[model samples]
Target: MLVWLSLVLCYLAFLALALAMPRHHEQLRGRKPGRGLVWLLRITGAVLLGLSAWPALIWWGNPAVAVSSWLGILSVAAFAVAMMLTYASGWWRTTLAGAGTAAILLLVLPVFLHP
Candidate 1:
């Protein structure tokens, strides 16, 4: 679960970093964040990304297995978050709420449903 959570958080961090960019101001709210905000997003995103390895390491003893599993899970999680944010943002009150719900269901449902 931590692994999945980290991937989702990393994607969210990516979105934050993207929104912090000046080019995204119009799409976001016609407002650009200050340099400090942009730096915050960038640093936070990097830190969240780096933390994603913890769960993988705990689950797999081998470095190769841990990294490979992390990469695979990260790829799927990133796509799920990105797609939900891109299309659902216009449909819901908040993109994070919509995307997060979808991601939680996709990644977490099976764990409880079949366990």
Candidate 2:
């Protein structure tokens, strides 16, 4: 239970970082990101979400394997890519809002359902 909670918390932190990427990128580059980059961020976010959920499914199937923990670690990498894409995109505000909301809901649902 503790490990799963930690994974969820880490994922939430990554989501927050991803949400801030756009504004940070703009300040660094002195220009807005392009539409293409926004799309990239969205795709990356989706991928991270998918990867993060995989571990829980695997844990259900086989708790003996250590692969689930590795998947959780990979989620951090996926979140980094998502953040980079968000920062590179000009549509940071919209993407951040959507992703943040989705992340919160995803993290909360399991707690209530499983508790």
Candidate 3:
């Protein structure tokens, strides 16, 4: 479950990074994002990508496995993001919203369920 959560985070992080580019932002929304929004997206994407590794570390406990798993998850997420951008650009907002909601739920559920 935590691994799956990490995948979602990676997906969202890629999505944010992709949207930070003016061309991609315009492709999806028909206008370039403002400079402030672009910077916000870039920083948020970086932080989320970093945080995505935490789940693997928490789940596997071995640094080697955690790093490798995170990279593997990142590969899958990056491919998914590319496909989405190529074929379903119009759905970006919806996809981001759903993933964000799911990530939040995943982060919270284990705490409540385990405790």
TM-score of each: 0.66, 0.35, 0.95
Residue pairs with backbone overlap in model 1: none
What's the lDDT for all of these models? 0.66, 0.55, 0.95
- Once superposed on the true structure, which residue ranges of model 1 sit more than 4 Å away at CA? 91-115
lDDT of 2 by residue, 1-115 (tens): 4345335544544544454457744654566667677567666656655556565555555654445664655576557546656565455455456556665676677789894
Candidate RMSDs in Å, in order, are 4.7, 9.9, 1.0
* Model 2 misplaced stretches (Cα beyond 4 Å): 1-21, 27-30, 61-115
Worst 10 residues of 3 by lDDT: 106-115
Highest TM-score: give the candidate number: 3
Q: How many steric overlaps are in each model, in order?
A: 0, 1, 0
lDDT of 1 by residue, 35-97 (tens): 898788788767766766776787687899889988887787667656755665453237566
Worst 10 residues of 2 by lDDT: 1-10
Candidate 1 residue 27 C-alpha distance from true site, Å: 1.9
